[model samples]
Target chain A: MSTNTTTRRLTMAQAISEATAQEMARDPRVFVMGEDVGKYGGIFSATTGLLDQFGPERVMDTPISETGFMGAALGAAAEGLRPISELMFVDFFGVCFDQIYNHIAKNHYMSGGACRYPLVITTGIGGGYNDAAQHSQCLYSIFAHVPGLKVVVPSNAYDAKGLMTTAIRDDNPVVFLYHKGIMGLSWMSYFEGSTNEVPEEQYTIPFGQARVVREGSDVTIVTLSQMVQKSVLAADRLAAEGISAEVLDLRTLVPLDRAAVLKSVQRTGRLLVADEDYLSFGLSGEIAALVAENLDTLRLKAPVRRLAVPDVPIPFSRPLEQFAIPQVDNIVASVRGLMTFKLD
Target chain B: MEATAEQLRWMYEKMIEIRDYEETMSRVYLEAKLPPKIQKGLAFDIGAGPVPGEMHLAAGQEPVAVGVCAHLRRDDTVVGAHRPHHFAIAKDVDLNAMTAEMFGKATGLGRGKGGHMHLFDPAVKFSCSGIVGAGAPQACGAALAAKKLGTDAVAIAFFGEGAANQGAFHEALNLAALWRLPVVFVVEDNKYGISVEKSASTAIASNADRAVAYGMPGVLVERNDALAVFTAAGEAVARARRGDGPTLIEVKTDRYFGHFQGDPETYRPKGEAKELRQHDPIPALGAVLRARGLLDDAADAALRARVSGRVQAAYDFGRNSPYPEPQDALLHVFAE
Candidate 1:
């Protein structure tokens, strides 16, 4: 890795669109379809200028039909085409879950290997802008729970581009979920940390690889997507207090980086899982289980703590929404609590 | 072309088989689910049945399946809604394996991973979903596959009237019409989607009318007769096979049983199921065959006996089959 390589700062959405445009240009089989993806340039600007370059045949705009386009993508993939289908929002999976889970995620297995769905389903996730219950959700855990889907959630623009390129090239179905709060949209205030220096050249990031944003020895804050930024901010604040907190951003959930998680937690001896998803039966619980299962070799100074959304619909009010979703303050407080813990 | 005598007889026999199979399932699904074997204060337990989980039996809706499937080949794909047995049986899915699947046996389709509503028989190009209106887009996909592969195989999606209101139905229609994919959408208007009536859930009286909005020919089968469904489905299938485009056909059928077997159906009116039973398509088709001098009393009895024996043997196979190993549930989640 040469640090002197030419790189330009790009937003998460621009990075994703660049990756998609590069892949489409590289591979004749790669095409994109979704609502407002063609002329309007995607609701989150993930496919900004593809229509003009690739034409309607490649970067087509689909009707507002998640089930229709998602199933069509699966079908097209089954017929030797790589399709990138956007679902506007992850919360809309309810209306078309049958196509997502029963077909897209299960067809290859159910067909006993006769059918392989090489497709990418991209959707926006997380709730920081108070889009209410139906419009905002970080439901990547639900997709990760399913068997056939590879779940990729990138934290920054650089990883977003690389991971998206990998997702589009994967033979199996992949659900690439991006947090709207981290996309750097002009309308919504985003974490500037998510916008990073991305190379103009095409690149790919392997799944199941976790990136340690900051190396520390006291506590490990394991998170992904939007929470990674918050965790980083909390780590920065905790660093001033001499807590020496570490932040681990899990890039993919299905092919999870179990080794990195265990190695980091093994080093720190204190673990705090910060997630934007629901509090129970989700990524937090899954991470906790991983630690508990490896307790025979790993030692811990304090119990593992979790900071996530409480079990409730994301409220429209900013105060309620902020209180529900894990914020920098919550992560800082959780890490502080872990620091003060004693083995009574 | 009109229906030949042989095709009519085949439709009648298939209808009888579907009716007998569904009736058998309705009875078997109630076993170990009633009073005294359940927890206190509960009228019935859906989970306590021999065939556990919710069972949506297509008893009086045999015509829609037989009619549409009669025009389908083994290579043609058929996607059915939650109440899917009739379509599965009509598509010639293995009766014993399908029955065993509902029984959650290791010998069943999907190896008991998919219960009654989620049967996947790729050999016959047949699959179904437990979700309402979920099959339309998938059917389009299958049709798109056939088109891309340069084959004449058509795809059929069988959903309910209530599903027409779902966004999937509209989107699939527009997509199929836009692509000119060889697919046929059949709506079995059985009056109710779970407890809500068609009049309550759907805005229009007929789902066929909605197809025209998507620039496709819409045909409505007013009667729940097999011959009527056969004629409409034959035309739609022919149009699809010719690569003309997609067509939507709505069959005014009857749901003999509740949405699921354990449903109390307090939302339905008194004598509604009884009224639907009076117009049972199984016997109605039999009369049609008799009027054409194609079936005598002896022939009808022989057909019924043959169908009943097959249905009973399937139930026996299901009942005798062993349950899937508990650990086996973890398998088949992904392809190796």
Candidate 2:
């Protein structure tokens, strides 16, 4: 798969739709099915033009039963149909969790490996939409804990397309989290036409490598999803103060790039984990703990700082939501906080 | 009735095996050593005898399974919910495997990893799914597969009235109708989902009413009377086999216990359960057979004893079976 070098521009949503379309085109059995996925072309338009292209049988529009359609996707896969089921909101995962965990995850092992239930379950995660209680949530950690399930969390348009393609092609069941906020994010170089454009041909990017979005040696800021953008802004602010900060964008959560994180920490001798979810059990907390517990090679550093929302649900009000999520200012304050942290 | 008297006897024996095995499971988990949840949900972990856990026993639901399974061939598949003992028995899965699964042993169905809520037995073409209203679509998938393979083997999905509210029910019924995919949708209205009564849980009094939305035939049956359920299921199954499309069969029955073991159910009106007890299917059928001169006390007693012995054996096998190994636990994520 070659990267597009032209000046053609597209949003993250467009990239994802392109990847899905290419995969479905490559495999006749690969079909798209979900609520409003056909005629409506998905709630966020991620499935645009598929219904007309593939017709109603393949690009199916399903009733509002995540559990049923989700299970059907796996069962169909077992019967030799490559299916991609969509969950409109990742927060609504509880209703159809059985099909995902029980039916899809355990089918092969239960039958003694006589089957391959390949499925790409895509769902929209994260909040900046003011969708309130049930609509907005980042539950990757809950899914990340499950065995036999691969999780992909992309921070940019290019990675979003490539990682999703990889998830679709995976032999095991995979969950791809599409951040709502990043769908419309402006990529300065690619989508903005200021830099190279994505190629039109079929391609996919590998998972687990953390992209060093902005390089600096004074301190390292590790984050993922939309938080990566916020970390970049924080780094820019730190640069103005001559406190250079390195920012790492964790494209995937499950096969986490620990080596990159450790190296960055060792180089900078200081670390700050900026996360979208609650601070206590988030990926950041786990990363910081791993570094502190085993960072004997990085002895010249200060205690790792973490910039995560306290343990609380995402509130509805704008201010409350801001307080519940890590913002650019929060990252800046956190980077400043780590300048004098002492573990000893 | 084209089948011989021996086939009928075998069907009855399978049903009885499920019943007696469930009783054995209850005894072991309760008075013997297991918990009620483990005992009740054992139907899934083991071969599909009396269905277990969180959902009520299909003790009274066995005849539905027997009568329906009586029609399906080996390639034909069936999907069931939490209380799915009857379907497992109908499919003829290994009793020992079902029991071992219930105990979370390696030898069990799904290597004890599936637990009771997620039972799978490819042998009998029965897969016990725990998701409420989840199995219907999978049944549709199986039917779609059979159709694609040009096989007349119809897939039947047995669920509850509570699941009729689920999105899968609507999606599947519509698909089955649109494609004539050879599927039968049986809704066992067991009267409750946990404490939510069917009358309270569903906007429509009967799930059969929802079938109108799919532009298909939806019928209500008396679950307490096995003959009625048999007759309804027969027509529906036949219609699906003939490629006429899908049928929604809602069997109205009383669950007879709290939603689960130790539920201390206090929702029903006083004596409502007592009033429903007189309509129990087993005795009702027994009375019918006696009046028709088709049953003798000696034969009936012999059948019960035989069923009890077999169930006892299954219980012994599951109880003595070794637990799953810790390292081997990771095996089989993907089938080869």
Candidate 3:
């Protein structure tokens, strides 16, 4: 049934840049503004070749002031302009948090529906290379925790394009967190399909929808962003061990697709949450708590296990950072533990 | 620009209307603070009225709102500070809806979600923030839109002297000047931010002095005189319309009431608030009109009565408006 669908191979960076370009072409009100987004073609190349196509007006390069530019985006959104603001890194949310949290997130609510904030704050997240603590961290949950902002983290190039389109079209503020490791940059090594087959046509993947990447019955591994790739690798190892593992990719964290998760858990009877964010009070904990609340209905065979970064800043050293972040080996271990659980 | 008799009278009427509305808000807020009856074990009866939460009254500072907003059109925007009642009124935001919002009524601007501190009127392009200096950058955005859209519409940002110290404020000024956005940053120097005096907080004697660093005109107006404020705002608005970037105008104003209703105000000298009231711009505006022969004793009395009646009607509208269901809070957080 899917054989007729036409697609082309593209990297996650290409998919995102194409999505933004298409949106900007379609809507004059939609424009891209951020540090190094114009002449620099974006440091991650997510905005490469956009400046020449769209010109300096549409593809803007802001000063090194996140708060100033982000706040300007909020105002422009409020004034009926669709602004796609790029915060260079997710870790830099600290300086401009007031604009994002207090203003951008609350404008629609605080204005009593009088205002519609059509804003997309796209930022790079996750750490694989030695970018150190500041540059490498996936804090999607921090944005998801706040109300009024829709949080989306795409697993592959196909999902990246679709989700970016949806985020641009969304009237309320949407936080588009793309993992740097999954961008398929020449400088970075990523798994297959990190740059996958994507359709050229503009399309949208609705927020709060989860995709079952690899379906299985023995266990369900829930993860998102680059971790989706890692979880799939772990599932592969579990499959080799004669244990079926289902990998669920949560495309968006806020407006989370809890139904898809519960359905997977119901079938698998065991669940393992792998998150790249901080373990305590984060995506993993939230998922575990969610499943725990539905234990009676879902009828899990055992308690949900979580593999995430320990409660510490990402380390500078490669060994410490690797140990701190969740890895495929850790996911395999957690899934193995889940398979060995015996109900009393 | 010299103020004509008609224009002076109009400014006086706006100032008086704001004064009356703020005074009414103060009375209603004080009533909300009353203890509950013995039948209820609650210290304060939540059911007594729809009005709840803090009230930041802009009483003596009516001249700032009146003057700045007079230069703004419906399409032009104004982003205000926490003390936004006067600005909302002067910008011609629907008084009935604003009052209803203060009462937490369903008909309020935010459908009873945002109270006085966060009133938003899209028709007038008016919005305020509870956070200090948060509105400055936003105002620049609006001005950017106008500039991009090739419209002469300018944006005004209303903040306090204390907000001048905020990083957002400096960043906004720098950005506006850099981009040459049509925004006028109006700092209403009400002398106090909550309890912290401007002297203790800000190092600069005048917030306007910092405008030179951003390469924009800076002016200090006699805040108590509506004519003086109006003249200063006129020049800034013109400069912005002429694509001359932003201007910083510091209006040396005063707030007759505490930062919020029910504040003990122990930080102030015993008679400071009362003494400041002697320089209240509402009456000063009326005197200005009288001096110009635009208003007589009978006309002044008639204007005050009409303003009081309108304010009273707004209060009645608020009292009659329905409070939103608890579930309504969950709505409007996302777009439909």
Candidate 4:
């Protein structure tokens, strides 16, 4: 439950900042470091006032060296310190990759299992704004290659707080990627247990659990991060046609809650995976592979469908970008196509 | 000396052992007894840059590794650039395993995943990146770990003058200075990177001068002299141990052979290889010790003979050691 009034309207950035602030007060080691995390609060103002409250030592403004600072966080974590690093924009993770690929995720197993880098790196990924090729792209697949790294993507204010706390508490190094689109919104009174409610203390949500935002049986829709909202909108559109859909929000990708997915699939013989990132080699493909490998008693009425961004660089034009990314219309059409289409 | 003459004698043994090991290994490779490790699919990535070689040696620059490693513990990290045989030996890595690694057998350090140039054994503080200047910043991170964790550990980055010209080398130095990390940038200037002479790659007269730009103290040393290396390293190591931050050491020297095995001496000044061999660090140290009355001719001969025996023993072990199981190669590649 988040701290909000009955009629409070909060943006996604405000929700994330609230979650971070409450956690820092909960644990002394929860510090923030990024390009503009300090005096700038955050480029999106997600870390505003954290600097003045926590002081320079706790809230740091790191150099533009992503690899250096990212490695510093991993190194610090190996020695019994917890670091929460921020990449001003997710696209910049390219500048420093040895930190994640070689250092953070590999530290535990490479040290002959003597160490655990409990580090959480937060970033804003994907496109919507006019931030062009170099600045816009969801590069999650690159990280999923690492063995000991957890991937967390939050869709709503409640899930953001819950998933981020899970990442912080996780023993392995985790990457918490926040989508830029799920940001400014006034829908605070909708999500259950979030009556703009406030808890006086801190808490955490368990990792690898899928939250069912909407429950139905005609079809099962699996989505993550910002794509969850798009799928929900699509499901609402599908409801008018007398078709019910079950929407499962996979808050964490690494420790995927296969049980939730299997149950939804068993109830609804059809499945569609909608994701903001490209479809191939992405989380949806991995899940589909799992389903094919398992082949439980769940018989499908139609073949599974995957709706995602096409395998092209994010274009800058608003119309083209809109056509490029998978919106609710795409999800609705893809699910509808699977629900009644030929199985051949 | 309160440091114990026995410990000092052990130190002497380590340096002698490292020097003779390289000299004998060079001959072994030259004789082609050490089979080339490259298979059809796997190529030997010489260094971070594209320097090709079946085997490389620290050659005439033995004391730099011997002296710096003398002050380092087995748990500490020693990051070496391309061609890092000296650092591999000084930290007391098993010579047999290292030789087999050069042979690209299943018994290699990375189980054939890493060839001679990619040698790394974190258990004994030995690791090298094929990339030139890549290890410097990582070493700074490793040292920062030690400092933040409140440990006495330090990181040693062994690179060449060419690597000091790399942006990573500069960035690593600037960051290490800003953080006051416990690291030592040990630049082994063999006066050339592959074939491009230092005259062309770098403008700073010496590797140590680059340290001044990062707000750190830089020192130059006669790398061919082992005692000079030991005494100089003792000061830098002591300062690091005192939490006084990093030191940049530019060891001015030359190699006795070409950069790698099988190179025609087209790059070197005529007769320079033979002339430089006279300054081989082990013999140079022996001469200094003998002049100082610390060693006698008989002791020097015995030291050389003992080193030769050790080299023979390592060769025998490597020659007989079994290759890694065909599938065991995949064991450490991924974490369970």
The Cα error of candidate 2 at residue A22, in Å, is 3.0
lDDT score, candidate 2, position A201: 63
Per-prediction TM-score to the true structure, in the order listed: 0.83, 0.80, 0.97, 0.81
Per-residue lDDT over B1-336 for candidate 1, one digit per residue giving the tens place of the 0 to 100 score: 578888889999998898888887888888988888888888889888779999898988999999989888999999888899999999999999888888888888877777888787878888887778878888887787687668999999999998898888888999999889999999999888899988888778888998889999999999998989999999999999999999999999989888888788999999999998888887888887899999999998998999999999999999999997898766765544
Query: For candidate 4, what is the recovered fraction of reference interface contacts?
Result: 0.11
Ranking by TM-score, best first?
3, 1, 4, 2
Maximum-TM-score candidate: 3
| Native contacts recovered, each model | 0.37, 0.49, 0.78, 0.11
Worst 10 residues of 4 chain A by lDDT: A187-196
User: Could you arrange the candidates by DockQ from highest to lowest?
Assistant: 3, 2, 1, 4
Q: What is the lDDT of candidate 2?
A: 0.74
What does candidate 3's lDDT look like per residue over A97-120, in tens digits? 999999999989987888999999
Candidate 1 lDDT: 0.89
Q: How would the docking of model 1 be graded?
A: acceptable
Highest DockQ among the candidates is held by which one? 3
lDDT of 3 by residue, B43-124 (tens): 5443455567777898888888888777778999999989998899999999999999988899888888888889999988
Every model's DockQ: 0.28, 0.34, 0.80, 0.21
Q: What are the C-alpha RMSDs, in order, of all predicted structures? A: 4.4, 5.6, 2.0, 5.4
What is the C-alpha local distance difference test score of each model? 0.89, 0.74, 0.89, 0.73
- Candidate 2 DockQ category? acceptable
Given candidate 2, what's the lDDT at residue A234? 82
